[model samples]
Target: MTTQFSALFPGLDNPLILKRYPDSSDANLQAWDAADEHLLKHLDESGMLPRRWLVINDSFGALTCALRARHGDTPIDFAADGRTAHLGALENLQSNSLCQQEIHFHDCSQLQSLGNDAAILMKLPKNLNFFADTLSQLSQTLRAGQQVLIGAKAKHINQSLLTLIGKNLGEANASLAWKKTRVIVVTADGKPRPLSKPNRWPVPELGLILENHSNVFAANKLDIGARLMLDNLPVGDFSQVIDLGCGNGVLGLQTARLYPNANVHFVDESAMAVASAMANWALNKLNPDLGKFHWDDCLSHLDAGISADLVLCNPPFHQGEAITDHIAWQMFNDAKRSLKPGGLLHIVGNRHLGYHVKLKRLFGNCKTIASNGKFVILQSVA
Candidate 1:
């Protein structure tokens, strides 16, 4: 694949390169989007000198790298929940030979101390609830009259996003479209707005109450895939279990209760997901010491020798706006690598995803545990 980049900026380009797995012959997509370029251009035109800048949700480090290159010696603090984004940013910076010392990276959950002088540059996230939560966090850190610039595709920068910004922060205005991208400028009003509470609802038959933040999948209801997996939970003395893409931690929490002796590991790529899972775990009075939470890309960089006896997963089929099974492939591979001998991997997927095929290839044996109209539960032994 060609590493084509915007000529307007010399050092910035899409650096997070990976082919869509299981379909390697398919074209690799660019990591950075046009919205990233618009934000960089807005920064240039505003003559914004390097103050403490906070860049949020920068996919593949396009904005952060470009800003660093343009304002060399200026400090930029980058925050993202995705491990891939963090790693990709670092790799891109290195490829451009930029000093890493000037850039600060933070996990999304620990963003309380960003300075008052910090000018915020954000990419509108796909999840509006998560987006709103981020705005609430910004409201706490920003001083009155501070500028916050948000970049998004013109289609996504609608009245609703602007309304959310105005309600939570201060008044917001959108810039003229440039290459079908728009920059939204919001000024902090110094008045603190109440953040939206996580949604909690009952699953009556299961005798469980689940909580989810706005951006989580199936926030309003239990997902069909998860339901299928719940019904097909393996019958074994699972002493250590992991919910690999544990969105709301429902699967892990249930596993923890069912196998009281087991330690549950909850992992997801979203900071908000991790936060919600932690909250739900506490809300259910699950032993904090019994569960380990990691915001990660699959199980990459997890502690070695920390294999699990059973792993539950409902792997995501897409990454960002691109629809691909690469993440699911990675999840399956990671499960295989992290399971002890004779350990089990239980998974639920859309019927058409054909996870059985992938599991069969990875584990050398795959069993259909249960199936409904649109979802299926599959099992593999390591």
Candidate 2:
């Protein structure tokens, strides 16, 4: 895979050659999209300078890097909820030979003060609830006249979305389409709405209570695949266990409950997922010493010299809008790498995904431990 790809913006000194953060082999996919281009264009054309500016949800560093290149040394606040996206931005900054000191990065969970004079530049996220939560938080930070410029695909920018923005921030409208994208201009009214709380649910059978932040998958309840995996945890006297791609840490929490002596590691790419997992682990009153949480792309950043006796996963088939097996493949490969010899990797996946084939290829042996009509549980020894 190529380490560098270029994105061009009008009036810029150089085309930004950037890589997807966390560096994937998928060269066909880009770090930024047309909506990102449209946002930068609008920001440039308007020539609206504010006392402060914040960029949110930039998939990589496209918007922030371009802004730094054009407006040299200007301080910008960048907020992202995914560790991969945050890491990607940092990598892109260095790749483009830009000053990393020009931008301040913030975890979406822990936003700092933006003051009242700030203007916001944002790429509309796929999840509306997460968007709303962001706006709610911003409403408190911005003043009555501060504007929030939002970039989105033309089809996704509609009355309902506009109303949502209006309800959460202030009055909102969109510009005419460009590059099949539109920019929603929101004026903050200084009316702060309550940030939406993470959804909490109970698993009566497992005696586990799960709390999920807005962006976490299966926020409302246990996933069917997870339910199946929980029901059929691999029988082992495992010492170290990993819940790969653990959404809310349910699997890890259960692992702690079932195997009191095992050290359970919870890992995920989403910062919110990692935070939620940590919170759920605490909420469940599990052995605090036995729990470890990582906000990581995969096991790539997991602690060195740590091998797990068992790894549990319910691999996600998609990342953002792209429906692909790349993540699942990566998870399986990472699990294999992180497992001790003779250790087991147990996973639940959609039957149609045919994860058994990948596991068999990786481990040279795979077996179906359990299955139903839609999901299958497969295990491999490393």
Candidate 3:
């Protein structure tokens, strides 16, 4: 079930072996898509000279790895909001026997003040607000005549998108369609644009203030699924708790407040989400020792011997642009494996997802804790 493929870029010394983060068994769903190929092809044809390259929004390191393979020993500053994509790139580097020291990693917060004279390579993110924010920050770092290359599905690049790019960055144009995808070329005009701040709101009912970064789920408000889950949190004398796929750490923050004696873990694939969760935990004045934040792919990198008495999840049904249930499946399986004997996994999912079936398949029992029109809360005992 290991999903690995060779990525052949036009100018690479050899094809690099690539795999998606939180690897899935489905071969049809590859780590890289045609948009990635289209971008690389454009770069290959440009014959751009070696320079400090900034790579952003690389789904699973396809753009990063291919660039590294082509430009060895060049300074490549890789920025990804997702921890999985960052880790996946490093894993691919090791798998391909490529130099690990060639690439430098950064979270979104650290992207500012990176200085000028760098070529930027980016894959248009699913969240346009986040993309605009990124472009705004780049405007501060890139001078006139410097360009940023963006790759995306052709259908997603329209006049509005081009307008947004021009407003945030500079002149923008899409290349001719190649493989039903296009690489957007944007030049910086040396004019700095203000970056957008994270969305903040107070959930007075829960007595908590939540802030969500651009890429985090449920921006500016509580998600219905999470709301249902929050209302139906399990009654237990649990000590160690994990909020799996903890976007903005809302569930874990509540759990920490409810169980003052328990150690709560907030884990997510997004660095921005983890940072937001950490900030929220502190802003709420929760017991510092009672909270731990992890930027991770499910529980794969959780500390050893960290079995949880309760695991809470409102699992994501998508990874980047692909709307699939593989991540949800992975979260349930990981929850089962991470729970202690007699421990429980509590989850909130849309009714149509049939999460109960997956939980039953893994744990042999699934019970509905609560249900509303759109969301259902379910529990499974380990």
lDDT of each: 0.80, 0.86, 0.87
Higher-lDDT candidate among 1 and 2? 2
Number of the top lDDT candidate: 3
| lDDT tens per residue, model 1, 69-99 | 6667678889987777887788777766777
TM-score of each: 0.91, 0.96, 0.96
Model 2 backbone overlap count: 1
lDDT score for candidate 2 against the true structure: 0.86
169-223 in candidate 3: lDDT tens per residue? 8999899999999999998898989887888899999999999888888888899
For residue 271, what is the lDDT in candidate 3? 87
- Give the per-residue Cα lDDT of candidate 2 at 118: 56
- Candidate 3 off by > 4 Å: none
Q: Backbone clashes per model, in order? A: 0, 1, 0
Candidate 2 local lDDT, residue 327: 82
